[model samples]
Target chain A: MTADRPRTSLLGTTALLFEAPGETTLETQRRIWAVAHEAAGFPGVREAVPGMNNLMLVFVEPPRRPEEIEQRLLELWNVVAPLPIAGRCIDLPVAYGGEAGPHMADVIEHTGMSVDEIVERHSAPTYIVFALGSHPGYCYLGGMDARIATPRRKVPVLKIPRGAVSIGGSQTGVSASDGPSGWNTIGSTQIAFFDVNRSPPALLQPGDSIRFKVARVLR
Target chain B: MIKILSVGALATVQDLGRTGGLSLGVGTSGAMDPLALAAGNILLRNQENTAAVEVPVFPFKVRFERSTVFAVTGADCAGRLDEAPVLPWWAHRAEAGQVLSLSHPKQTTWRATRAYLCIADGVDVPAVLGSRSTQLRGSFGGYEGRPLRDGDELPTGRSNGRAVPGFGLVPPGLALPLEADGVPAVRVLPAAEYDCFTNSSQDALWSTGWKITAQSDRYGYRLSGRELNPLRPLELRSHGIVPGVIQVPHGGQPIIQMRDAQPSGGYPKIGTVIEADLWRLGQAPIGSNVRFIRCSWDEALGASADIRRWLANSRRLVELHCGERGGR
Candidate 1:
C-alpha cells in the first residue's frame, strides 16, 4: 500500500525523517521541527533533534518499526505542523580585522573590499541562523552574498580560538570553543556562547537569526 | 594503581558514550571498537558499560600499586609481566609493585581494540551525560580528564577479591583467530540522502568493495570508493548522528562515523551500518576493502541484543579501578 504523508526519509532502520512542505526553507523547517518535537515527547520516541531544514527522529522501544513510525509521524506531522511559532533573532557585536579575524585578509581579497569596507558590509545585514552545533554556540548563517562566499582553508588548523567568527563558503559562525576548523576567521566576539551550567547551554540554535555589529569588546 | 610506562597516541578510557549534550556541540567520545571493549569487559566478568583503556598507536604499560585482578581483552598484542609474553582476550592478576608491560602490535587485524583492565572492582571515573566515556574535545571524563600517562596513580574500588592469573603471550606474526583484511562488508540502512546518490553510486556503495583509508579512528572511518553522485548536494538540516552513519562529502569520499562522533551533523548521510557488524568492522584495519549491504531494523536489533546478552553472561565481578563517579 502507498503512504499518504509529508515527505519522509528513513534514518537507519529505526528512525524516520519528517520534512515540512513549503517553498521556502524556514517554512519547511518550522513544520519539520514541530512534528519531530511532538513525536520526541511520545512514549516510544527515543530522541528528537531538529535541524535547520529537517528533523532526525528515533524510536526507543524495540519492534517500533520505521514503517509504523512513518505512518504515525505522517499523521502527527499533519496535525502538529501549521502551529504558531516564530524563530528568535540574536544580535552579535563583532570586531573584524586585526586579531579577532585572522582570515580577514582572505575575506578582503575575495570580496575586493578594503578591510574597513568589508566589516561595514558584513555587519549591515541581519542573517538567519540556518543551523548550529558544529561547535558549541557556533551558528551557521546562510544569507551571505555570493560575491563574499570564500572557500575554506586548504589546510585546516587544529585549534581555532574561542569566540572567533569564521566563514566557509556562504556561511559565517561564531566558534564557542577552541577546535579544529576549516572555516576562515573573519572576526571574533566576546560572548560566552556555551556554558553547561546555563539553562540553555548553547547561545545560538537552528532557526534563529543574527545580525553582526562591528565593534571591539574582548574581555 | 598503574604507572603508564608509555602513553599511546590519543588513548583514553571509555564506555558506550554520552547523550543529551549535543545542544552544546559536545561530541560523544566512547570506545572506537565497542565490541572489543565489550568483549574485554565480559571476559573479565565486569559490567559491559564499564570504562576501559583506549590506546591508539602503541600498547600501554602499567605497574600495579596494589595486588589486583584484571582482564586484557581486544586485539592480540605483545603483553607480559616484566617482558614475559601474555595472551589477549583474557583476564589476569598482578601483585603489588609489579610492572605489567604491553607492546603494540603491527595492527594486522583490527584498526584499534581498547583494553578494558577491569580490576577486581571497576574504573571509578566520574560520569558525564550518563556515561564514563572520555570526550577529548570537551576534555571531560576518563583518567584525569584525559588518557592515562606515565606515573599516574589511579585508585581501585572495593574488590571482588578474586584473582585470574595472566594468560600466555604470543609473539608478533603469530596465528590468531582474527586477521586484518582489506575492507569488510558492513550492513546499513538508508538515510535521508540515500536517494541523493546516483543509482550507479548507490549500487557501487554496495557492489564495489571500498578500501579503508589510513585515517581511520574512533571518530569516523574515511573510505576510498567510487563517488556516489547524489541527486543533489542540497544543504541539510542538522540531525543527530549515530555510530555507523555513512556520510559522503564533496569528493564522494564516504566517512563512516564511529562512537566518538559528534552527536549531530549536516552532511548528507546515505545510510548507517548495521549494529551487528559494527564490531567486525571495528577489527577490519585500514586498507581493508569494505562494502555495504542494506538490512532491516530487525536484523540490527537482534544482533545488538545478542551482543548485550553475551556481555551480561561473560562479565566478571571486578573491583573498582578508578575513583568514584562525581557530580558533573
Candidate 2:
C-alpha cells in the first residue's frame, strides 16, 4: 500500500524526520523500512533509522539545505510500496512466574487470566519485529494479544536485568541489556540479545520474528 | 606505560566517539569535551582522534613507567609533576618513575569541570567496533571496558618524537569563543516536536536560563528551569535521537542528551542544541545556569563551520611552533 504524505520536519541541524501515516502498524513499518533502505543511498545520507511510524534521516555531510532532503523523503513516502522480505524465526526460552518474572502477579491481576492462560496466549503468536529502540537490541515487536497488555510501571525500575521479557501498555518485548526500565517484568529469557563482537550486535533485527517458549517455572 | 596511582571519582580513556553505529542501537560513546581532546592532540602533533584520559573527579594521581611527552587540556586542575607545578593546556615531558597528580579544579579564567590527559602516543586500548571509546552501558571497549582504577597499567602507542616540550596552544574555549547573548549559552535549532509544545513553553525555552543539575553526566544533562507545559499532553513513541536533543519529560524539566545517551528516546524534544555548541555545554559545570539561543538552519551550520575553521587554524600555528628548533 502507498503511504500518505508524511509530516516532514528537522530532527536537528544534522537529521530530518518523516512521520509516516497511520499508527504503529505492520504496514506503516514495512513502508518505512522500504523508504529507509532506499534513502540510505541518497546523496549526503549517512544512515536512515526507522522508528515507530517514522523515519529519521541522519546526514553524514549534513546538506546545505535540510528542506531539500525533507522534500525528497516526502516524495519517497508517497510512492514507496511495502517491500516484504523473508525474515528469520527465533524462539526465545522464558522462565515465567516467581522471581524470574518479578511482576508476573501484577499482569495476572490486571489481565484477570491465570498463569497458564496468559502464558499460552502470549507465546502463541509469532510476533513480528517492528523496530529496535529504547535500548540496544531492545526489540519493538508486533502481534501481541491485546488481552495480555499491561500499563508501564508508574516509577521505572532502576536496574532491570538483561534478557527481561516484559509488557508495557499494549506491547510485549524483551530487554537486551541490564538498565532502567518502566515495563512490567512478567518473565525472563535466556537469549543473548546484544554482543559488540558480533557483526550485527543486536541478535534481533527489524524484519525478524520471535516466538516465546516456556522453559520452566521459577519458584 | 602508566600506572594509576590513586584514581578519584572517575577517569576513562576517550576518543572522538563511536559514530555510524546508531543503526545497530549503539549510541556514540566518547569524550565529553571533544574540542579539548582534539586540541590536546594538535598540541602534541598527534592524530586528532587520538585517545586521552578524561578525568572528571579531582586529586587523580598517576606515575609514568617511561619518559614521555604529554599534554593536559580542558579544566585547569592544578597539575604537578614530581613536586614541580605543570601548567594546564601545556605540553610537558615527564621523567620515568615520576608521579603526576591533578588536584581539585580551581576557579580560574574559565569555570569548567573535567580534564584531558593526553600522552605523546595515544592510549593503546584495543578498538571495539572501530572505536577506542568506552561504552559504559554495554560494558565494552576501552581499557577492559571500564573506568581506570589504582594500579591499573595502561599501554601507550608509539610516538614519532616530533612533539616539543615547554609549549602549548591557547585553550579552545578562548580561541573558539562560542556564546550566545553575551552569557555562556548554546545555540539551538528547532526540532521535530518544536511545535507540539504550548507557546508559553516555547517562549520559556529561548528566554529563561536553565540550571545544570548535579544529576547531569555523560549520558545527559538534566536541566532545571521553567516548567515547560505542552499545548496538550503528548505521548511520543520511542524514536532515533542524536546527541544534543533537548527532551522534556513528565516533570517539564529538560534533559539534553549527550555523547553516551541511548540511541533512542520517547520524550518530547522541543529543540536540539546545535552540534557546534555541544562542546560548550560539555564544559558547563554542574550547578551552573546556561541560556539557549534560537537560530536558523543556516546559522547552526555556520556555527559548525566556525568550529572547523578554529581547529584548522590552531593546527597550523601548532605545526609552525613545533617546527621551530629553539621555540620557547
Candidate 3:
C-alpha cells in the first residue's frame, strides 16, 4: 500500500474525517472539496463528502475497530492542505416588484429607499454563491448591496412564488421552486435555476459568481 | 403475505435511509427510531436495513393475507389481534387471515411513538435510489409517496429461504420511547468557530435550556430560547451544513437541523450534534426541554464509532425478546 494510504479500523470500517479551514464561504468550500477529492484519489477510501467546513472521508469495506480509523484520520488531516475556489461567472435577468413579487414594498421599506432605488442598488452589485441548499439550484449567496441589508421577515411568507429574487440581511438568493420564505422579496427572475433533466440539474454551485440585469418597464 | 387490517395514525415502509436525492432536496425518510427498525428486522432474522412498516400512532391494523412471520418493535403500545395482547420486540407467526393491530400509544404527545413491523418476506416497494426508504417530500417512495392507507395491497420479495416463521416486538423496546428516565444526555462538538462566540454566549449555550417548538418538522427545528447578540458584527458567507447542525442566527434561539435538512447552510453554526446523539433529537417531542454540552472532536469521533457498534450488536439481543412467527 502507498504511504499516503494509512489503514486504521472502526465500525468494521476505516474513515478519515478532515478538519479543513477557511473563514470565507467559497474559500472554505473549495478547501474542503479539494481535500475530499484528493482523498478519493487514494485507495481504500469508499466515500469522501466535502461539507461547508469539514470533510467526511470513509473507507471501503472497513475494519471493525474504530480507534484504528480515528488514529489514521488525525494523521491525514494534519497533512492535507485545502485549496481555494476557482470558477467561471454566470449572470441572470430579473424583474422587480408587482404581482410577481408582492413583498417588494417590504424590501424597499427595509432599505429606506424608493422602489426605483431598490432596483438600482440591487442590480448594481454582483453576488457570490455561498452555498446550495433547501432546494436544488437554490443558492444562498453573499455580496448583497449592504444598503438593502435587513433582517428576515417578521412573519415568513407561506408560499414564495418560484423564481422570486429576495434578500436576507446582506445575503441574497433566487428561489428555484416555489416554497415558503422569510427573505424580503425585491423582485422576480425568469431564469430557471433548476431543471430535473439538466445534466447537473442546478444552474449555479458554491463557487460560481453571478450578476443581475434589471428588467425595464414595457411601454 | 401479511395484510393491512389497520394502519395506525401514520405508518409506512422504512429502511436505513434514502440518500443520493439530497442534492435534489429530498428528505431521507426512514424509521424515526432506527433501533426499533433493527429490532423488527432482527427478530425475523432479516437484514438490519430491511424494509419494514413504521406505525406512528393508533388506528393501524394489518392482516396476514396468507400465513407469514413478522415482528413489532419500538414503543410500549400493545399490539392486538381480536383482543389478544402481543409482544413488542419478539417475532410472531400468524395464521391466514389473522389480523394484527397496533393501538394508540398511551405515554406521549404529538410526535412520540414507534411501531415497526418486519416481515420475513421483505416488502416489495420499488427501489428508488439504492434504498427502499421513502422520500416523502417528493412523493417518491413507499406506498404511493405517502403512508399506507386503507385498501393498499403490498407485494412481497421472494424469500431467501422457503417458508420461515416470524415474530413481534420484544416487550418494552430499548429505544425511542419517552416518559423514560435519565436519558443519556446528547453530546455535541463545537463548530468550526465554537470559540467565536463570547465567553458569555458560549456559557449561555451550555447552561441554557431551549424548548422544542411544535412548529418543528422534517426540515428543521426552530428552537425557542433567550435572545442572543453576537460579540462581533458577523457576516458569514453561506456554507454547507448537515443534520444536527446548531445554527445560531442574530436571534439567540438556535435552529437544529434534522433529517429533512438541506445539504448546506449560510447561518453561523456554533456546534454539531454528534452523529450518535441525533436519534435523541427524534425522541425529543415538541415542548420538551433540550440543552447542549460540548465535547472534543476526538471524543465526538470516538462516540460515533461506539454508537454504530452498539446499534449493530443490540439488534440481535433486542430481537431475542420478541416472539417468533411460525411459517405455515
Candidate 4:
C-alpha cells in the first residue's frame, strides 16, 4: 500500500511538520525545499526548514488557525514544482578505519564486507545534501551505497567527536560537531563543517554535493 | 559591570534565543525557563528579549561593579545583596561594590531549578545571528560562547535610567500552574508517529508519571517510566524538530527534547510537550516526577495564549508600579 498523501502533524503548538509520503527521493526533497521557500513568506511563519523529505514551519507565534496553515501548505506542496538548487560540490579527505573508526568493525560485521570493500563503496557515491539537521552544520546526505549500509547502533554513543563520518541505516553523514549520535562511525575527517564566524555558518546546504576522498586507510 | 565571584557550572548568558538558523542545523539555545527570563526583564522594564544570566547550578555569587537595577526570577535562590535580603521576582537596586549572592533554590513555595538574573538593560554580549544566547554546541554566542567562570566579569549594557527598584511581579509559574493530581504536569499533543506506538504505550504515556532522570539537561530530558513500545519496529528519516518533541528510541524510553536539542531526529515520536508548557518542564528539578496531560491542537494554542496573556498583564502591572514610584 502506497502512503501517497502528504501527512501534516502538529509539533506541539510551535511548528507543523509536513512529511511527503512514499519513498525518500531527491525529487521529493526538491519539492520540499520549494514548499519551504514558499511557506516561509506566510504570515506568522518564522522559519521554514527542510528535512530529509519533510518541512517544518516554525511560527513567530502559535498559529491561531492551524488548520488553515495546514491547508495552505498542502496546496503549496501540490502546486510548487521541484526546485533544483545550484550548490557547490566539496571534496573531503576522510581517514577510514583504525582509531578514527572505532565502529568500522561493527559496520563490517553487519554488512559482511571487508574494511577495504566498505571504504571503496562508501566513497564511491557523489552524495547530495538532502538536508541540514541533527546538529549545527551537520548535513543529511543522500546517495550512500546501500551495500555498506548498516543499521544505527542499538546503543548510541554518548559523545562522538567533530568530523566523525558515520552510516545510519541507508544514510551516511559526517558529524559537524562533537555530540551524541547513534550512527556507526566508519571514518573521520579534519574539515570543519561549521564555523560561526563564517558567513552562512554551515559548509553544506540542501542540493550540495559531497565526494569523500580516502586520505588514508589505517587497518 | 559585575564580577563573577563564584559560579556553578552551566550558567550562561541567554536571551530569547536565535531563530532562522534551524535550516542550518542550529538549535535554539536559550534559558531553560524562558518565563523566568521574560518576567525578570519585565521587572526591570528591559526589553523582553534582553540577555540575562541563566543560573541553573547555584551558590552563584557576583560583585556589582556599579549601582544598577537587577531582578532575580524563577527558582528563588534566596538572593542576598550585601547582607540585605533581595526578594525573588522583585527588582532591586545594587550599590557599587556590593556583592550579590544566590543560594540553592528553595523548593518551599514553588518547585523550580533554574533562575534568571536580569540586569537593568541587559548583559552586554555581542549578539551572534540575532541573539546573545550561548549556543554551547556551536560555541559562538553570549559571553565568549561558554559558561560563566570564576573571575569572569560580564559587562552590563548602559542602563536606560528608567528602572525603578522595589517593585515585583508575580511569577508566571505560580500564576499559571498546571498539575496532574498535585504532581507538576505539562500538556502534550500527539505527534506525527503517535499512531505508530502501541495502544498500551500511548495509554501509559498519558496515565503514568514519568520521572526526570539525572541525565536530563538543556539538550533533552531522559524520562523514565513505563516503556513506550511501538506497534512494530519503526524507523524514521531524520526530520526537523523543535524543543518539546518527544522521541521514543529503540530502548522504549522517551526523551523530551529541550532548548539545546538538535534541529532534527529519526526516532519514532509518540507526542510532543506543547511549547507553552515547556517552561514548566524546564524548571522541573531532576529526579522529580511529572505527568503528561494529553491535549489537542486548540488546547495547546490556548495554553500558549494564556502564557502570553500572563506576561502582558504582569508587564502592565510592573509598569504601573514603577511609574507610581518614579512619579512620587
Ranking by DockQ: 4, 2, 1, 3
Which sequence of candidate numbers ranks them by TM-score, best first?
4, 2, 1, 3
lDDT of 3 by residue, B175-250 (tens): 3222223333467766645666788878777777778887776557788877544676454433445577777766
lDDT of 4 by residue, B136-251 (tens): 88888989989999999999889968788988887877888889998999999999889988899999999889999999888999989998888877767788899999988889
What lDDT tens digits, residue by residue, belong to model 2 across residues A42-67? 99988888877787888885589878
Best by DockQ: 4
The interface root-mean-square deviation of each model, in the order shown, is: 4.5, 3.1, 7.6, 1.7
Model 2: per-residue Cα lDDT over B133-219, one tens digit each: 988777888888888888899999887487788887778677767555666898888887788888999999988889999978888
Better of 2 and 4 by lDDT: 4
Badly placed stretches (over 4 Å) of model 4 are none
A3-119: candidate 3 lDDT, tens digit per residue: 233222121112333444433345555555565556665555655544335455454533344455456555655575666565568778887778656777777666678778777
The positional error of residue B1 in candidate 1, measured at the CA in angstroms, is 3.3
Query: Candidate 1, which segments miss by more than 4 Å at Cα?
Result: A1-5, A13-15, A23-33, A61-64, A81-91, A97-121, A125-132, A136-159, A167-171, A181-185, A197-211, A216-219, B106-114, B161-183, B231-233, B312-328
User: What local lDDT score does residue B72 receive in model 2, on the 0 to 100 scale?
Assistant: 87
Better of 1 and 2 by DockQ: 2
| Candidate 4 displacement at residue A11 in angstroms | 0.6
Model 1 chain A is weakest, by summed lDDT over 10 consecutive residues, at A1-10
- 10 residues in a row with least lDDT, candidate 2 chain A: A1-10
Q: How high is the lDDT of residue B257 in model 2?
A: 88
Tell me the spans in candidate 2 whose CA falls farther than 4 Å from its real position: A1-4, A95-124, A145-157, A168-170, A182-184, A214-219, B178-183, B326-328
